[model samples]
Target chain A: MAKKQLPYVIGCDGGGTGCRVVLADAQGQVLARASGGPANATSDFALTITSLSAALAEAAAQTGLSPQALRASVAHFGLAGVVSPAVAAQVAAALPFDHITVTSDREVAVTGALGGADGVLLAIGTGTIVAAQRAGQRRDAGGWGLQLSDQASGGWLGRALLEQVLLCHDGLHPHSDLTRATLADFGAPLDMVLFAAQAQPADYARFAPQVIAAAQAGDAVGRGLMQRGAAYLDLALKAVGFMPDEVLCLTGGIGPHYAAYLAAPAQAAITAARGSGLDGALWLALATARGLRGGAA
Target chain B: MAKKQLPYVIGCDGGGTGCRVVLADAQGQVLARASGGPANATSDFALTITSLSAALAEAAAQTGLSPQALRASVAHFGLAGVVSPAVAAQVAAALPFDHITVTSDREVAVTGALGGADGVLLAIGTGTIVAAQRAGQRRDAGGWGLQLSDQASGGWLGRALLEQVLLCHDGLHPHSDLTRATLADFGAPLDMVLFAAQAQPADYARFAPQVIAAAQAGDAVGRGLMQRGAAYLDLALKAVGFMPDEVLCLTGGIGPHYAAYLAAPAQAAITAARGSGLDGALWLALATARGLRGGAA
Candidate 1:
């Protein structure tokens, strides 16, 4: 009797800070998982490709599969900086798979959360971006960047906290416990604020947890920033035509926390995605594999 | 021969908004300014007051002199809100003065411009408010209001025109020539925007010019709301101490325009005799009476 072919797929999710890869079978069981360094394809394509490759190799090693064997398998990538067609092609070229597909990290997250339904997905982690999928079309709202936009992201919160500290140092605002703690973390003279803000968005986002803690401890400045941040997200939701009963998915680290602050309309619209970028990638991989079978036949 | 006491001193300058008044002498000055709807206080307060107030008493009419004569007369007032405690009080209480003295309207202008000399000022009109002056003290930088805070000012050009319109439209942010023209005129959907944003600080500010123009165009939405209308002035300049520049001054509108914006700031900051409220009021009236000072005391 002929041996039966195993049904498995490979998936990758890449971001500015890191890349994650997962190997899974048809039963939705993860066989192997691996992580690596930054993989934002737009800003640093070579480094992103290298990290993605290493992560895939690490996952394959766990499965005891050679590079050649993995190359013949189906795979999908959910990657940052893949908004442009040229960038998407570059990401696709980096991955080794018989059938591979690439899409924006935002698109993958939306697909994973809503099962490819029509709704808005507010992905706010280290950075913030709002993407709306309606009637098979997509539109982007905020997420200009750390400097000009991204009004409700972790980075924005950090920047606002730093601004409050600087304002206090300049005697332009009242000094508060949160400002004191923030100044202590960064050291005296307070001129370092300009330097701190010069870092990339993800670097700034890492400081958001401290701000959240400060807010919870009754820091009016911190609390105000959070409220403003949530309000910014609400504005984005309004831009996307968020219906009261629509299944709006909240993704990323800060999304869950910010979800609590959303109004009844937004709350009723809220639903957490069952799968993340990895799951979406895996789904794409399986779909690609099915397409390959039909094409070959 | 004994010198006759000039009991009344009147100072007036009118421009694109309304007329202003200052009644003072060498010893001290009192102020009374009235809004004539849309008369320019920077150019002709004399004519504007005719329409604003029921009747003008000639004794202190043109020179801000009181109907009753007093000794030693000096009247000066910069057209717009200049920094001065006396000026602020006069504007606030509508008090007529003898021996009235006013300084650069810019001084009281800062109170209204920065919302009360404790935050950044971004006054945008024909000019801007990028000035970084601290209250009652000299700093390394003071950009002269319109010349400096232009970054945040409506007169800053570039993105500001677009931002005003976009912010007005529920943050939908559509860019078009029609939108730009509508923003310049402060009409239509813009009227709705101004009404809806009456409570928000940024929104109130964004819609102020719209309200001003609507009143100019004889629209009902703009005419009847004076106190709330003035509150927009208070809100925009409210964050004076939010940064190192804790004092602001105005560069737009006419003399009485500054009065509306400065009323709250003067009440909050002027608790003593030697405050900017009085000083600015005296300075504005004096500046207007520069040529007519006769002889120094």
Candidate 2:
């Protein structure tokens, strides 16, 4: 009798805030899933490796497989902070699978969004990054990290909210209902808001929703920030070679909610990705197991 | 006979990028001046304090006065990052003057422009901040630092340049003479440009002039950035209880350069400060030496 073929593949999307893992078969059917925290290899290399390992183990456990069994399988990880060779090697070493591949989260996101075809992908999560693909060539825009770039990400939005609050506090911007709501959410005498802003980029980014709420509620400054955010994203997408009619896949939380801000042309180009990082990872795993190949054209 | 009173007073404006000390007597006489680097008390406390001390000492030295003799008189400092009591105390201690007063660079600028009257002041330098004063009550806007805020600043303009370059690189934004000029200035191979942006906020900010040049050259995106920078500054100014007929004082390097962006009301409010940070500082010191007389109120 012929030996039974392994029926599952695994994928992981590791980010600054968390790591998500998905187990799927060759047909793109989800077999299991798991999550863990703070796995951005660039920011916290050891933690990222540990978290990726744990998340993969958890997903395998859910699928009724041992770590060794999972190690024999193929896997792919779309990870944040995989921009350098060292980071990629560290992350690859952390995964359980033998046939493992790593790429910038943005690249995998573009691939997942376009299904390995040519297109533009705008990812605006805690940070913002845009990737464009044309005839197998890839281009990137923004995602310069929180300090000097990532203009339209959740981090950017959150920073905008805090800035508005500071403006209101200092009497440089109007105090709107949204500002009050945001202050209340942050629990402030205003100094607390400053502390939050000074603490971390991610801290401010967490309040991006409140800013969106304020914009939704008709605060002009808030609205302006949202409009600019959308414009910045459009600019980023355009940077990656988007044109009048190309499909632009909107990924990340802000991408879907803020879709209305894109121009008709950009909106027409916008579509949701069928799969996320997990799916991309799973696809990589199955491809590896089947000896699927990409050629240098 | 009463000792001949010195007809002019000296004013020192200390900031993050540079320091300027202006000698103007009681009659607004401009006598002598000099400039140097990074004197923002909050961002670079020691350096700024040292620079301030040195600039003042140097100015006095040029006039044949010993540092201690200059210390016998009063001086005031309108400085960046002097917002906190500790910073204020630190700056106060560093100065050689018998009486020295410290206040936010914003307050002194407004006072200098408005002659201690109620008005709004928009200051845009490496960072942007607005301050408004009415009936002795003061409020602030923007100026959260380079990473998260400073909308209409030199820094903002510079970042816009980088954004444009990235856009061009990715084919999102169009390339123009401005883009070519900026890339050339930065010696761009794309990665070199990226490396420069990654190096420091100031490095990016230095390119702001390119955007200004582009605006001058009729690049829509470049023009839009300048206009938007002005608009953001206007929004902050407007938030400060602006009245249609009220005066608005525009100060700082970018502030004066982008004066065209201010709305009519904001423009009407716009006036050049008679004294800069140094004058403001002198005023504060004089007021303190005079025992908090009627001037501040």
Candidate 3:
């Protein structure tokens, strides 16, 4: 005889770039997926809520379940900029989930990357997310925003590139191909000075691709930056209790690019992520639903 | 025979710290001097104007001349944050000088350091000013601001120190006494993250003395930072056409501290500044008056 269907669950992964939502069953069976606009709670809470709601509604429609009906079951949201319990509480109040869990995007990313197992996560993009998970507990270092931390990130690479260009302009350092081209792109050092004054982290991250490509092609400055970034990553992984034999998932727009620069041990430990942050949210949602039903979570 | 006394001239040196005004004869003889509150135009334009006006009035009073009488004389202002022609124009329009020359503080600092002779100036403080003065013209490389440039400055040293502490916390590098003490000061790395988020260049500069002292004591991190800073200074000095035999005036609260870290040739070139920024302003004002009199300028 066929088994009875389980209650529907919802999971949402929100960030500055965009949002992803998943529809699934309490047993962790995926039903449908949906994408939405940017959902960074810290950047635009109202817009983030709208994006999440629309995406949840879309995923629910794909599974032929009303969002309200899914909300009655269980839901989990892993969102960027949810740095504190107060922020998570605010997000929970905004969403229409009856039984919902809200957490930082890093936690979900690590969960998805490691498939809920113990390992390390290096999510380096415009910002750096260095975290480790052990027995379902998560710990992180760095990612303290660009002004203080976020070292070895795309933003860090781009900012360092600009600084090098100015140094070359001053005749303190000779202009490598990377520095020369970068300075040329901005017209002059003064123009770069103007850009740096107002450029945000994302704005600086725009140069990461160039730096990555240059590093691959043996540009001294580019390779130097990648090496520096790799060194920081090595330190961060060790700080997070990353054993060389354990899975080390290097994920993000810029993370994979550093694979070539990683130490031999980290290179050996590198592994592809099992799933995405949305998947991790769905796993969490499934666990929440099972717990509420008095079943093994 | 004793030369006839020339008309009075005025010179003002205004910075974030405070403003100084000197009243002197066109022949460069000092008449009187006065001081006023902070006059950083970018920080508070109205207050800068007030500071300048009050200092000018006070100096005129000491010389037994009406403020209005001094306004008829030649005056030169070397001011911080006078980056553009528009800013200088605004300053000129606000002050009551019949003939006024407005320029960047860096220019006057170089003049004061070099005493109107061609040489290099290394002015490192919360900011870094690297300039080469030649035949009445000045060319500068850094001093773009703390955001992009200002390498080897007290601000840069302090910021790097904080970055090192974070790196150590992440297990990326070993901590020295400097980093350990620095981390202890904040109680925890998170506290430092909090402090750095709102720290200005000056705020970071507060840690420079500790780093300086630690380097003196042979603390590994402190020495590393000083060495790195000295490397940048070497490049800047070379870029500015600094020669082993040429005069190199290292001036500023943090400038002389770097003497021990400088290269052998740079150490050999070091010379005490002939005067101060205030004296440079006076020299420029006298020059302006002499030009007006159709005499040697």
Assess each model's interface with DockQ, reporting 2 decimals per model.
Answer: 0.03, 0.25, 0.47
lDDT of 2 by residue, A1-297 (tens): 775565467778776667898887756678788998766666567877888777777877788976677776667788876767776887777665577888878766766677778778887787776887888888788775665467778878877777677667666556887777767766753354346434454666777777777778887777888899888877666556679777787887676756878777888877768677666667667777676433311
iRMS per model in Å: 10.6, 3.8, 2.2
Stretches > 4 Å off in candidate 3: A1-75, A79-82, A86-100, A137-139, A293-297, B1-10, B14-73, B90-98, B137-139, B293-297
Question: Candidate 2 residues B128-237, lDDT tens each?
Answer: 76877788888777776665467878877887776666566556667777777766766754354346434444555677777777787788878888898988777776
Per-residue lDDT of model 3, residues A1-297, tens digit only:
666445678888876567898887767778889999767676568988999988877887787876557767688898876767887999999988778899978877887789868888998877788998889788787876677678888888899899878777777677789998999988977678768866766678889999999989999989998999999888787788788878889887899999988889999999899887888888878887777777633
TM-score of each: 0.56, 0.75, 0.85
- TM-score winner between 1 and 3, please give it: 3
Quick one: best lDDT, which candidate? 3
Please report the TM-score between candidate 2 and the true structure: 0.75
Ranking by TM-score: 3, 2, 1
Clashing pairs in 3: A172-B235, A235-B172
The single-chain TM-score for chain B of candidate 3 is 0.84
Q: For all the candidates, what are their Cα RMSDs to the real structure?
A: 15.2, 6.0, 4.8
